[model samples]
Target: MEKKVFLLPFASVILLLHYWVTCLTLAVSLTNLSDEYALLALKAHITYDSQGILATNWSSTTSYCNWFGVSCNAHHGRLTALNLSNMGLEGTIPPQVSNLSFLASLDLSDNYFHASLPNEIGNCRQLRQLYFFNNELTGSIPQSLGNLSKLEESYLDSNHLTGDIPEEMSNLLSLKILSLFVNNLTGSIPSGIFNISSLQSISLSANDLYGNLPMDMCDRIPNLNGLYLSYNQLSGQIPTSLHNCAKLQLISLSYNEFIGSIPKGIGNLSELEVLYLGQKHLTGEIPEALFNISSLRIFDLPSNNLSGTLPSSMCCNLPSLEVISLSWNQLKGKIPSSLSHCQELRTLSLSFNQFTGSIPLGIGNLSKLEELYLGINNLTEYGSEGIVSTSDVYSNGIMLLEVFARKKPTDEMFVGDPTLKSWVESLASTVMEFVDTNLLDKEDEHFAIKENCVLCIMALALECTAESPEDRINMRDVVARLKKIRIKLLM
Candidate 1:
């Protein structure tokens, strides 16, 4: 009787264990079914599939794991990755995608996906990589994206995305590359972003973002190699701590409202290859140490308030230097002859500055030079014997005389003159009498040289002020004529 009682209890125990096992199996099946349904929802949301990749392959006849652009974990049979990049798929990301609890990566870039990102995507707690760049996606980035704490790389650039970058994004401790370039994002960059030590590259260029860079920028990002923040309305002095990013290779902060001197410490970046800091309100002398970075290829710092002379050996250590643009600044002194040392130089623009003295004679030796700009400065042509060439003086004189004639057309000095045109016509012969006596006090013996320069200026000025505009030489022709005159004078 005792043995029978024990057997009955054992049978009941076996039945109970079987019931629980069956329930667990059913739960897992339901979960997998939900994932399949989520994928189907995505296919439904798609408006157009130009390549028919999804329409033809994402059919109910096959398992969701075998569908196009879909991947599943072999062990758990759960969706893990979906990459439809460059497939010409046009769709809206559906909220049903949140059902993919095991999803780790998603890429739908280079397509026509539009509308705000579905906030439910944050439910995929395992997501590590997200790419939505080169799409027509609009509206604010969903704030729930901050919940993706495991995300390593997020590329949402080249989209029509608007609104401020979510401050909560600083929660991504594992984030590496965060590229939001070419978007309409605005507002100050979240200070916490710079604190993420794991970031390798952060490109927020071509946006309308404003405000200063955090004072501690690059303090935590030791491995940062690329930083692009151009074409923004960002103001205030650039953070001096930027030099702390020792691995920096590219730094583009041009076309902004930044107001400060270029940080001298930036020269310490040995790996820097591209440095663009133009079209701002920067002042102070160009740092001589910048020339020591032999890896520098492109150096552009134009249209600023930078002053002082360039170092005599500016290009001595730069073997890879290709472009140098420093135009429309207040920089003065002679053009450095050392610039000819950059054998790879393709472009050199130094126009509209306060630079004076004769042009460097060795400039003509640059076989790779494709573009050269030296206009609107106090520059004169170089002479073989180091004296300013006659034609060079004439070109400089013509510009000054034109300015003087325009500013004081009715000055008392021209009271008896019929017109400024008539005065210039006779400027060559009577040039000595028209000037202040103190100007010619030192050297009065060079009257003939001065007369020839004035005569050349007179003829060019008359041609420029011809009665009919159609009869006057175009500006390009005038420049060519001046170059020819300089060549003849040199010969």
Candidate 2:
């Protein structure tokens, strides 16, 4: 009886061991066999496969492990990767793709696939990377995608995807890159998604998203390096906590309705490279703190209501600045002379403002100055004389020399003698010849006299430059003479 009982327990242990081994064997061979059907289903769903790689290489006759874009684990014989990016394939992604139970990576980027990402995608429990950016995929991102507990990266940008980002996305604790920019997404950003500690990059620009940016931004996403949320309806003050994102390099929140002063300590962000915050409802003086960020490359804050004087020491402070555009603001005060410190300043436009005072004379010293806009302002010197300024004129000399330079569009040889006086004086002998031949016909009247346009124009020039100011012809006489000249030319 004791031996029989012992044999029963031993047999139970052996059966348990056999079950585990059989399941292990099934797992090893299951991936390739299941992936063959999955790949075939994918081929069947493809309405347009411009390249016949799937038709040619993926077949029942060949091993599924040998198919193009299909990568398998040599040791386990499991389908671990599928990359059909830029393959010119067009069609819906079949739910059957999830049958590749051991798949780790799936890339259908830069293709024409147009349908909701299948909820079955979550079945690929080991999936670490999902690349479907630059496709025509529509409909909401499946909530089931949150079931991918192991997912590390997701790219769904440049698509037609709509609806709120699923709150279930917060389940992805390992997510590092979440890019869904340039989509048709609406609604406020899901605050829970920001809690993902491992996230390094988040791009949701060019969407219809609205609402105040969460004030606890840095606390939630401390590991972020790039945060692009531009071209949305975001309003309210830029959160002060943003400065705490010590590793942040690129911040683009432009084209929004954000109001109030820019965060005070933003300049303390030492790693910042590109800060684009244009077309917002922001106000206040240009912060001196901003100029101190030595790592700044492109600082754009145009089309705002920001006012006040720029710090005079900016040239010495901002050494890395390359592009700065502060146009269409209510800013006033002198353009700082120290701007020459930014030797690398490639583009500096400060147009359409109330900036008074002379442009800093030192600006001309910037050897690399490419664009300078300083118009529509009260910078020109004025006095009690309500007239525009001009060069000084002598009493008897009517400034004939400078006047001549303004007329003819000729070279240096014609510099001194381009006036109407010189033109007529050179042809004075021709007048006598015409009179003698009666070519200056009395019966011809105006046409005959008008034909002597050069002579009349010169006569008027001589009259205007007479030795006595009183003898100088009035501007009306010159106009009449010009009319006669035109009449003669037309005749």
Candidate 3:
């Protein structure tokens, strides 16, 4: 019985020694693997010109595990993470990066890495966060990437990668953000991408993707918030199932070949801020419900077959609207006067439409209006008569001449002149006096004409008259004198 007890203690000691040796072997292997990857990176032309080689760093001498951008567990010294983002590293990612079998995160984004991603990346089975975006990596996505079961975010955007998306990517069930935009990727979007339940944002814009938008996309990923499928060849009616994306904030499907009226249910997206469905072939009246979206800041649906008068209550409810573009359509009827209430409006384009009648006088009330494009419309003798005065036109002409003289000049100063400057000034002052009392509340108009117009033209006429003592001064000569007068006024 005593001998049996002694054997049990001896066996336990042997097992403990075995475990210690196994751990030592693991630590040495990791150190060797780290050095191998560093060498491979250096040989592959990846460099830090500012700091020279990472292997040459003093910390690497003590142990390869102590290198910069490398972290290991305190007890085991197994590499757990490798981050080289924004390091200005160029050249292909070394396939030996897979040597770090225990790596849980690898970040190499925002670099100048070229060539295709190494297929050996799949060997990092424990990787949870892989950032390979914003690089010059080319070639198709490797199907081996599907082996990374723990990947949470895959950002491969803004590259020259071509060819179809690998179907194997659908296996990454933990993916939350998939951004492949601004690339040369062709072929229709892989249908399997919709199966990722954890996906919250998908940016696939600026690609060569062609085909109708998948109808069940939102149903597959109900948690999606931003869907950017713009600048593609997508056609056919917008899928009604998109309304299922209740949390969607930005939906951009612009520059597609989609036809048919916009889905009325789009108004259901209460959280939506930007809805860009423009440059399509959609026809029908602008949905009234669209204007009711209080959260909408930018609503663009231009270059379509939409017709009918704009709803008077459009901007009445949307107080936060900043940009509304509905130009190049078949819409008719007078523009709603209520649009003047949009105090936040910066750009309003309604050109190339069938609308008729005078523009509302209240349009001038828009204090925040910066650009107003009403050309190619039937707005003849609209409130424009009140908004634009003869003096305003003459002042604008002088300002234009000043700009032109600064840019270029022919031998004749008034090569483009067609009207008499003196006559124009007299007519402008008379018209200004007549409308100044009715239009302006402040006395600035009178002062402006007296100080700017009268002074400018009087000096100009003097210059012209001084050029030639006697002669029936031509309108062209008067214009040249006006230009000189403008220069004198500035001095």
Which candidate number would show the highest TM-score if scored against the true structure? 1
Q: Give the TM-score of candidate 2.
A: 0.71
lDDT of 2 by residue, 1-491 (tens): 45553355878999999999999888766655678889889899999888888878888887888888889888878789999999899999999988988899999999999989898888889999999999999999899999999999999999999999898999999999999999999998888887898999999999999988778888888889998888888888788888878899998888888999888778888899988778748899877888888888777887789998788887787787777777667888887878878888866656657877766656555667543444444554422223111101111112231132221112122324543335434655465422233334445656455446545554555575554546666555566767777776786
Stretches > 4 Å off in candidate 2: 1-27, 361-370, 380-491
How close to the true structure is residue 479 of candidate 3, measured as C-alpha lDDT?
A: 63
Provide TM-scores for the models: 0.75, 0.71, 0.72
In what order do the candidates fall by lDDT, top score first?
Answer: 1, 2, 3
Give the Cα lDDT of each candidate: 0.80, 0.75, 0.71
Q: Count clashing residue pairs per candidate.
A: 0, 0, 0
TM-score, structure 1 vs. true: 0.75
**Judged by lDDT, which candidate is best?**
1
Find the 10 residues in a row with the least total lDDT in model 1. Answer: 406-415
Error of 2 at 317 (Å): 3.6
Ranking by TM-score: 1, 3, 2
Distance from true location, Cα of 365 in model 2, Å:
5.3
Q: Tens-digit lDDT track for model 1 on 227-288?
A: 98988998898878878999999998888999989988899999999998886499999888
**True-structure RMSD, every candidate:** 14.3, 17.7, 14.2
